[model samples]
Target: MWDTEHNNGVLIYLLVPEHAIEIVADRGLARCVAPGEWQALVSQLAVHLREGRYEEGLAQAVDAVSARQAAHFPRRGAGTAYANELPDAPAVR
Candidate 1:
C-alpha cells in the first residue's frame, strides 16, 4: 500500500479461516475517511462473504474504495495517464 505516490492505497484483507475482513488504508486516506465509514464498508463486505458471494463482495469492495480514493486524490487531466501503483494479484501470507 505504501507503494503509491499519493499514499492512498487500500488493502482489503479477508481472513477466510475466521470469516473476517480488514480494511487497511494508507495514512493519507485514513486522515480523510472516518473509522466508522470504514467499518460500515467492512460490514457490507462481511454480509456478502457470509452469503458465499465472494466475487461480488470483492468487486464491490474495490469499487467502494476506488470511489473514496478518487474523492480525496482525483485523477490527472484527460491527457495524463497514471499507472497502477499496486499489483492486481492478491498476496497470501
Candidate 2:
C-alpha cells in the first residue's frame, strides 16, 4: 500500500475460524467511503459467512467494494489496465 502511486488501497481481511472480518482502506479510498458503509458491508458479509456461503460471501464482498472504488476513483481512460499490485491468491499467516 505504501508503494502504490495512486494512494488508493483496500483490504478485506477475514479470520473464518474466529468469525471476524476487517475492512481496511488507505487514506485516498477512506476519504470517500464512510465507516457506516463499511459496518453495513461487514454485517452482510457476516450473515453470508454464518450461512456457510464462503464463496458467495467473498464474491459479494469483493463486488461491493469494487463498486465503491469504481465510483470514487474511476480510471482516467477507457481500457487502461491497472497492474495487479497485490496477489490475487489468498495468503495465510
Candidate 3:
C-alpha cells in the first residue's frame, strides 16, 4: 500500500503484517517518513485488516497515492489513444 501527499508525489509503501504494519515513504528519490505518519497509516491499516478487506484497503491506498501523483505530475492529453480505431475516440479526444 502507498499513501502520497504533496506535489512532489511522495510514495509511501506499506507492508501489512499480522501483528504490525510496516510503512516507508519515498519522496521522489528521497525518503521522508515521520513516526506520526507511520502510526496513522498503521492505524488505518489495522482498521482495514479488522474489516477483512485488505485488498480493498490496498486499492484505496494505491488510489490515494495515484491521486497525489496525478496532481503533481499533471499528465496532459494522456487519456485514451489518439487513433480512430479506439472506440469513441472522438469523444475521448
Among these predictions, the greatest TM-score belongs to 1
- Residue 25 C-alpha lDDT in model 1: 98
Q: How does model 2 fare in lDDT?
A: 0.85
lDDT per residue as tens, model 1, 1-93: 886888889999988898789999999999999999899999999999889998998899999999999899987888677788889898998
- lDDT for each candidate structure: 0.91, 0.85, 0.50
How many collisions per candidate?
0, 0, 0
Candidate 2 global TM-score: 0.90
Worst 10 residues of 3 by lDDT: 84-93
How far off is residue 35 in model 2, in Å? 0.5
Candidate with more favorable, higher lDDT: 1 or 3: 1
Which tens-of-lDDT digit does each residue in 1-93 have in candidate 2?
645566667889998678799988888888899999998999999999989998999899989988998899888898998887766677887
Off by over 4 Å in 3: 1-18, 29-42, 77-93
Q: Superposing every Cα of model 3 onto the true structure, what RMSD results? A: 10.8
The C-alpha local distance difference test score for the whole of candidate 1 amounts to 0.91
Better of 1 and 3 by TM-score: 1
For 1-93, candidate 3 gives per-residue lDDT tens digits of: 123333143333444443555544455412333467556656776688789988876666656544644554564685843222213211211
Regions more than 4 Å wrong, model 2:
none
